[model samples]
Target: MNKENREVVRPDGTTIHYTVTGPADGPVMALVHGWGCDRRDFDAITGFLPRHLRVLAVDLAEHGDSRSTRDVWTMEEFARDVAAVLEAESVGSCVVIGHSLGGAVAVETGRLLPGVVTRIVALDALHYLSLFPAQDECAADALLHPFREDFAGAMRGMVEAGSPPGTDPALVDAYIEKMSAVRQPAGLSALEGLVSWDMDAALRETTQPIVVFAVRAIITQEAIDRYGDRVRIETIELGSHHFHVESPEATAALLAAEMSA
Candidate 1:
């Protein structure tokens, strides 16, 4: 399994970094990491995937090795970062897989490249009742107030909120530490972009079949009931919010199965 690291310059001058693996003509699988994380999160999963599947693991601008100076931090803009990579690689068709915030980006990517994207796979994404549903501008501001005021505390809160019962405290602390260290201003700004993103609007516009693999403990019944018709929700007992990292083999198998299906 040879992997090639590459970069694409977005129209806004931001550099989007990504890694390509597997065969050139194989079916494409675009993996997008969540907020505060990078393309490296998919390293283990990619290693476990089939050799015939072409994998494009992307680092959203300002995350991982990707660098950016643009002020616009919308999810759609992040999708453009991914679209740039696909265009550079000339990917005709792909299954976009995203985690957490990246799931929103995946939806936007599908909307942006409707003709190219075949399906959407979400790992512990799109089922948060408070986060996924459409919110009023005022409500969005209020939800982001704590993060704006105290970024560190907010990062810890996010890690803890995503951790299910029996999750190790060390793992939570590690994630908080790594996530809190995200490039200053951009890290905070990207978060603001995520909270302010209109997921309902994105879902309405993107008609791709979305398959959500949610952690059973963290997902609420309300979330499933609301988006059940639009999104296929599959509950799995896979660690915390970052279960893809905790259970890479299973996650890879799940994505492989989805791609084949």
Candidate 2:
């Protein structure tokens, strides 16, 4: 299916970019990308999906082609942005799938949209690592200061640090293209908010069928265990921190399967 671009005007006056793919009459599956990435992050997964599923992939504000007006970004703002996109398309209900930072936003979307989003798939994000409990001030300072240096340097460092080992050069290049375009100040500020926000309570409160694809690295078994039945945790063993690019087809298939279920 051909994808169409849309410009959604948020209440805050920011213009958000969203793309719709697949047949119009099928079940709608909304995809949200993680921090510093755009809607195209799902390219590897979207193409192979069944024609009966409509895909809506969005570039969260200030991340992809979407414009940003705020001096600072928060998880609440990100969640509202997703809601605005759905409202723009007049979507009444959908299966929401989000990756990394997008997962947190998806949870908030379920909360904001109420009965509209019946299912959620959080790929490789259950808990925010930076928010993990620390012993002392030094540890907290270390985590917070990791990106406080030069902005460009921080971005490059992030690319190196988060990418999966032995990742394809083409995939790496594509990821860099999406992430490098993020404005330094805006990206850093957004990261700060992401690090601080905790979504455990929200996840626990969600009554919708939620599946959390827990990445091998960063997330622990204990965290997944705590989620239990409310959160169906799955592991993508092929990739590291960024598994979407490494196993896009598998991710898409799982998404399609879950949405169908």
Model 1 residue 224 distance off true place after TM-score fit, in angstroms: 0.9
Worst ten in a row by lDDT for model 1: 128-137
Error in Å for residue 183 of model 2: 1.3
The RMSD (Cα, Å) of candidate 1 is 1.1
lDDT per residue for candidate 2 within 77-172, as digits (tens), equals 898889988887788889888888888788878987877999988887755445422214565456557567555565666666666567676766
How does candidate 2 fare on TM-score? 0.87
lDDT (0 to 1) per candidate: 0.91, 0.76
Off by over 4 Å in 2: 131-141, 169-178, 228-230
Query: If scored against the real structure, what TM-score would every candidate get?
Result: 0.97, 0.87
RMSD over all Cα atoms, model 2: 2.7
- lDDT (tens digit, per residue) of candidate 1 on 1-261: 999999998766699999999999999999999999999999999999999999999999999999998999988899999999999999999999999989989999999999999999998888886666666788778778888889899889989999988887888888998899899778878777887778888898997899999999998888888889889999999799999998999999999999999
What's the lDDT for candidate 1? 0.91
Worst 10 residues of 2 by lDDT: 127-136
